[model samples]
Target: MIYAILTEAQNKQEKQPDMADTVDSSIAVAGLKAAIRVASHGSFLRAAISMGVSQSQLSRRVAGLESRLGQKLFHRHGRGVALTDFGQRIMPRVQSLIAELEAFDALVSDTRAQLSGDVTVGVIPLVSRHLASSLVRRLQSTHPGIRLRMLEAYSGQVEEWLSSGRVDIGVFNRYGGARPVYADPLMRGQVSVIGTPDHPLFRQKDIPFNVLQAIPIAMPARPNSLTDHILGAAANHGISLNIALEAGTSSLIQEAMLASGLLTLSPAGTYVKAISNNQLTARHLCSPSVQQTTWIATSRQHPLTAASRAVEKFIKEILYTSTQ
Candidate 1:
């Protein structure tokens, strides 16, 4: 019996620490939360109410934090609170840690309930607005407590953020054939030549790059951009693209093409329903066509929380099944 008890103890010691084992510094979280609540809400009473603590208790927490840190976190006004410069400087980090801890708790709860936790996914506006929303919605419905933070940014910006540890997942077109640190094929589609329905070029089955180049076009600019990819592909084929505008948003680019009869290269999905509605005309930009692969990227160095991993799996499964 003693040997059996010893074996059980050994098994317990061998077990890995789960989500609850990782959390914000206990000393920091209490005061940091109080300061954040005070700074956000202004009034001590309100902050106290939100924290479910008395005003005196909240003040003591902040005061104790200031004593420990050797600096005051908030500037007390007659009836409100404001973050000091010191407080402001540390707030971003505090918020990030808090978010991570909250996510960790959700992960623990999910593990207990056999559900999944939250995932913060960063994506370019084009992809996030059109593609990932469905996946996000589907994950939310199926997984219940799974939280999703959808960060909308420019494609280039998204890549930078992914590299910097700001996001757990990213979706973007693979620009310039450069591979991400870790990637899974999300989807692949061809770039199409888009023009207004009434444009003169719309009459042709397909126009050569040279002819298309003669028309003023709107395309994205340099530094590993989707627009840059399209223009480079055209240049490689010995065609000069006359870009009249470099717009940031797809809506703007499509509108420009509609208003000015300018040409733009876009993914097949970009014009799917619009072309069907006769709002625009799209032809596969071939001879050979410019094709791009959309990929879901994650940091191999930063392991996703279990809940995040679960949601990622669900997203990939759904996307894969849909394509198949």
Candidate 2:
């Protein structure tokens, strides 16, 4: 067996003129990148900083790469680093490989820019009523290749969806407060008392906050931010709200309002169609009026794709028009 092994070794040595000229098969692309960065910067420390790695880590990668190729790629010195003669000869090819990779990446990005993928959006009910159709029309007209998916819910649910990465974009309301740090302010609208058109409050342009104490009101249940804001404001103003019914949704509250002649609090955006159709009347609450700011936000958990960004732009345009 030892004689056979010796003969095989001799045959392999004879076949290859120089074993040191052969590169190992396991050379990593990262090692190649380190070499290029070190060569380009002309300093190991500078390259390491730019690469977000320690100087020692960069040096080891370069050394491992050099060992694999059986050649020294850099001349280390106190001043900096310099490419060896062999390194200078091969660097152009290495740079070419990187350039090709970058070109390929740009090609993939261009494909994405076509906006041909699904984008999910989470929106509050108030905004979604008008926004959904307008956004669909706009996206269909311009970004026809994109497929859109929408989730309609209240502000709390929408926020949860955004945080959990369930949606790429979020449009919701923040009541009676400064805009959230991470959100982009879209528009501000008055919170109004909504009821059937025949209601006596419709005679006036706006109603004072204290008047809610005498009227029967239907509102979204507690644990709602908007409901909390209304209740808190009522307490501050020494006005006890006559919360006759506590419904889970704005639609149910609207129905209760219509049937029972109970007024409900809502943003102007929520009842635009009903008001225009003369099915309902909305008078802004005043004398310490409640205001809600609409905001467009994206999740840190879910990075926006090209399609998602396109949809976001369309939504912003639609909502901005509502403000005007």
The C-alpha local distance difference test score for the whole of candidate 1 amounts to 0.69
The CA lDDT at 231 in model 2 is 90
Q: What is the TM-score of each candidate against the true structure?
A: 0.61, 0.64
Error of 2 at 163 (Å): 1.2
> For candidate 2, lDDT tens digit of each residue in 154-227?
88788888889899999888898755645778888789989998988789888999877868888777767788
lDDT (C-alpha, whole model) for all candidates: 0.69, 0.78
For model 2, name the residue pairs that clash: none
Candidate 1, poorest ten consecutive residues by summed lDDT: 1-10
Off by over 4 Å in 1: 1-117, 129-133, 175-178
TM-score of 2: 0.64
